[model samples]
Target: MEKIRLRDIADALGLSVATVSNVLNGKDSKVSPATRIRVLEAVEGSGYLPERAEVLLGRNPSRMVGLVVNDHPEYSGHPLEDPYNARFISFLQRAAVRHGLELLVKTARTWEEAAQFASIWNMAG
Candidate 1:
């Protein structure tokens, strides 16, 4: 199914995107209560879910955590296919969720590859 975006909801309600954004972001003080209700109703009906990365990036440093698995191609191409890596990743995922973090997993054949992803994402420790 195609994803519904915030702009779609705003257009259907005949409201500006900014107004809809304000309502979704809990900054609805300037928006009329009736309009706020309408916007929310439309949003729920449309099933629009905002991107988590965008919301996290709004905060200082971001809430993104990267888990890089150093995989040896000699053993297997897929890092998560290994039982040990899978177990460790499962633990890390639970811990990250408990701390309100978004976990991004990457399997790198080389340290350089891992560093590249970490640098590009600016993943927090």
Candidate 2:
């Protein structure tokens, strides 16, 4: 099914696109309760993903930070078990959280594998 756009909902309800946007964005202080209810109903009926709504409005990338770590057969535990690696991971995690992003730690055997991780979500870090 095609992802529903705000324009479709607004047109169906005879409302301006901005009004529908405001209701979805929780900026509906000035919108009437009846209008809010109508817009919300349309949204639910459309199978719209709330996360995608922000992306459509702002064209934002997937807010993820990917950490590529090397995995060797001889390693006992996670590569992050090393003290230096652990500290670095902790710092990176803190930064990602501070910026409203998530840290995805993955072990890769080669550069090609690491590249796949980055491309999957448009990883920024």
Candidate 3:
């Protein structure tokens, strides 16, 4: 099915596109409570799902975080070897969860792959 547009809601409510946009984007502090409720009901009836990243960015605290670790001698070798990297990742995951953020760890197979992965995930050493 096709997605609904902000203009559609604006036209339906007899409001300007900018006003509808502000309400939908949750920057409606200047808008009246009745107008806010109308906008919310319109969104629900239209089955609109806001982008997760945008919503998270709008919140006081974000919900996304990333972690990356290069190859350490302690974490390399046989699977039975001491799982230092695994333990560290688990700890980081727990800490992130406690703070309401997600933790992602990725292992790169080569230096080139590692560089590419870092660029993709926006990580820096």
Q: Listing every candidate in turn, what is its Cα RMSD in Å to the true structure after a full C-alpha superposition? A: 15.2, 14.1, 16.3
> Could you tell me which 10 consecutive residues in candidate 1 have the lowest summed lDDT?
50-59
Q: What shift in Å separates residue 123 of candidate 1 from its native position after superposition?
A: 1.6
Q: Arrange candidates by lDDT, descending.
A: 1, 2, 3
Residue pairs whose backbone atoms clash in candidate 2? none
Which tens-of-lDDT digit does each residue in 12-109 have in candidate 1? 88889999998877688999989988986777577565676345456587677998888787656887888888999999999999999989999888
TM-score: model 1 vs. ground truth: 0.51
Per-residue lDDT over 1-125 for candidate 2, one digit per residue giving the tens place of the 0 to 100 score: 67677788889999999999888766899999999888878876776555543453356676777898887655664787878778998999999989999899998777656754554455566
**Candidate structures ordered by TM-score, highest first:** 1, 2, 3
State the displacement of the C-alpha of residue 82, model 1, in Å, after optimal TM-score superposition. Answer: 0.6
Cα RMSD for predicted model 3: 16.3
Instruction: Please state the error at residue 75 of candidate 1 in Å.
Output: 2.8
TM-score of each: 0.51, 0.47, 0.41
The residue pairs in collision within model 3 are none
